[model samples]
Target: MPWQKTFTLGNKRKGCHLITNEVVNAIQDGLQNVPIGILHLFIQHTSASLTVNENCDPDVRSDMDMALDTIVPESLEWTHVDEGPDDSVSHTKASLIGSSISIPISNGRLNLGTWQGMPPPTVATGGARSRNIQASI
Candidate 1:
């Protein structure tokens, strides 16, 4: 049988942060019995996204945040001002980064590259908020 669970992560900062361990911890119990399967993770927010990338270096994360800031600068003129300056750009950044990911589960473990892990994207919305994530295995 397949397993599914939804969990919320609270108060992530305004940039990419590694959450691989958190993800695993959230669904580890459900994953224990599965020998081989696929894990799909979906983030339920428009201003944030999910992606697998290098988790070894802190620079990689900072660089990504900087690059995205350049690519989708919050200073750009946008009509969606109800949220803040980062509003529309946040949506754009989320679209560019994506909101979901798939990973292979082998022997009840996530099959990811040595350097590849999940780093969630975030747009500085001026305040910290919760992010909902759904995991299916």
Candidate 2:
């Protein structure tokens, strides 16, 4: 049987955030007995996305945000500017990264790399805001 649930991540400024603990805590109950399975998470917004990365270093998160800004600079001319300058940039960044992630489960735990973690709500509205995430196990 598959287990599912929804959760919210509080708002933060424009940058990558380490959300592994938050996500795991929210879906901990569902992950308890899954000796072998997969955990899929989807963010319910276009402005923000999901990704796993090195959780040990704060620089990786900050650098990710910086790299994204470089990849999708706000100075460029964008057709979808209904919200503001960062609107289009935000969406583009989300698209470039993605809105979902899946990880393997082994012995009732996520089988991720030693240093890997489900961090970063990639981008956010106005470059930052709360994000709703749906988890399926």
Candidate 3:
């Protein structure tokens, strides 16, 4: 059987946020029943994406934002700016990073690497202020 849950997250920001706990806690009850399985998460919006990365240091998250800003700097000429300059940039970043994550479930816990955790990377000022991720187990 596959179980699915969509949880709300995000706000006005342009960076990566470690929301692993928030996602795991919401699906803890469902996870406990599955001794071995997979936890698949899909972000429901564009312009934001999910990724597993270093978790212990706050600097890493902030650094991620900086890195993305550097890679997708607003200095380039973008065609779609109906919303703002961040519009085209946000879409591009979303495509580059992606919108979903999958993790193995072991003994009712997510089997992530020691330094791995998932965050829906926020990009571009035109992206959604809040977002939702659909977790399927």
Please give the lDDT score for candidate 3: 0.82
Better of 1 and 2 by TM-score: 1
- For each predicted model, how many residue pairs clash, with residues at least 3 apart or on different chains? 0, 0, 0
Reference-based TM-score of each model: 0.95, 0.93, 0.90
**lDDT tens digits, residue span 33-60, model 1:** 7899999999989999999999999899
Find the 10 residues in a row with the least total lDDT in model 1.
121-130
Go through the candidates in order and give the C-alpha RMSD of each one to the true structure: 1.1, 1.3, 1.7
- For residue 28, model 2's alpha carbon misses the true position, in angstroms, by 0.6
Query: 24-117, model 3: which lDDT tens digit per residue?
Result: 8888877987889999999887778899999999899888888887898777998888877888777778888998888999988999999888
Model 3 has how many clashing residue pairs?
0
Residue 75 alpha-carbon offset, candidate 2, angstroms: 0.7
Q: Residue 42 lDDT in model 2?
A: 94
- On TM-score, the stronger of 2 and 3 is 2
- Report RMSD for candidate 1: 1.1
| Model 1 lDDT, full chain set | 0.88
Candidate 1, pairs of clashing residues: none
Query: Residue 38, candidate 3: how far off, in angstroms?
Result: 0.4
lDDT of 1 at 55: 95
